[model samples]
Target: MTYGEFWVHYLRAHQRTGTRALHYTGSVLALALVAAAAISGDWWLLPAAVVVGYGLAWIGHFAVEGNRPATFGHPVWSLVSDYRMLLLWLTGRLGPHLVRAAEER
Candidate 1:
């Protein structure tokens, strides 16, 4: 699927508030790790960021969402969409995405 198509699927996969919350938490922690790595020059933290971020998200996908992640097919777009979704959630603008996702379903 194209990025736009994958985004719609991503939104639907993350329809649950709990899943979104986990993703947000993971994204925030990943960002912090990146900043920390930059500040302390601990390059290892960069890999840790991927582990911490995708780990939590995958748990939510398997346990909460009961589905495979969109990343399996579209890794780059899925990663970008994760941050976009997190940004929208932080800005209190995720409701519209959720509505649109539900409509698609």
Candidate 2:
């Protein structure tokens, strides 16, 4: 699959059945925040981004998704996919239907 396809699958993998969709949401949020901070050259936001980003992600993993993160298994791929997904999301193209296409595969 392409990078775009990987991102959609990544999101789907994080979605839970009934509880809040915090894992994917948190991961997306953190990625966007970090990208914004990095682009703005705010060094302070760097630390905050790291803390908040991972904190939110962990919360989602342990609390919401209830599964080990793919990051643990595929660190580099997961990191690259996170940024790619964040860009896709920020561009307003990360809709449910589009990402849902990934599930079909």
Candidate 3:
């Protein structure tokens, strides 16, 4: 599917507010961990960050969303979409995107 199409699918997979909240938490923590790893010169924190990030997101998918993560099929797209969703959310623009995704459904 096209990038635009995948975005809708991505949003649909993250419809629940709690699911997205977990994702946003994971994303923020992951970035902080990465920064810590860089500033401290402890590269091992990089892997830990990945684990923390994906771990929380996986929990959301399985326990909260009751669905598989988009990462399994489209890793690159999923990663990019994760940040896109986060930025839109930070700017309070995510509501429109969510509405658009729901409309497509």
Clashes of each: 0, 0, 0
Report the error of model 3 at residue 54, Å: 0.5
- Which ranges of candidate 1 are over 4 A from the true structure? none
For candidate 3, lDDT tens digit of each residue in 1-105? Answer: 999999999999999999999999999999999999999999999999999999999999999999999999999999999999999999999999999999998
Question: Where does model 3 exceed 4 Å of error?
Answer: none
Q: Report every candidate's CA lDDT.
A: 0.90, 0.62, 0.96
lDDT for predicted candidate 2 compared with the true structure: 0.62
TM-score, each model? 0.95, 0.54, 0.98
Question: Could you arrange the candidates by lDDT from highest to lowest?
Answer: 3, 1, 2
Residue 91 of model 3: what lDDT? 96
Q: 1-105, model 2: which lDDT tens digit per residue?
A: 665666566676555532124434656666677788879987677677666666666677677767776677667777675565556656776567444855577
Q: List, residue by residue over 9-94, the lDDT tens digit for candidate 1.
A: 89999988888888888889999999999999999999999999999999899999999988898888989999999989879998
Residue range with the least summed lDDT across 10 consecutive positions in model 3: 48-57
RMSD of each: 0.9, 4.7, 0.5
**Model 2: ten consecutive residues of lowest lDDT:** 15-24
Best by TM-score: 3
What does the lDDT read for residue 88 in candidate 2? 64
Better by lDDT, candidate 3 or 1:
3
Worst 10 residues of 1 by lDDT: 1-10
Q: Flag clash pairs in model 1.
A: none
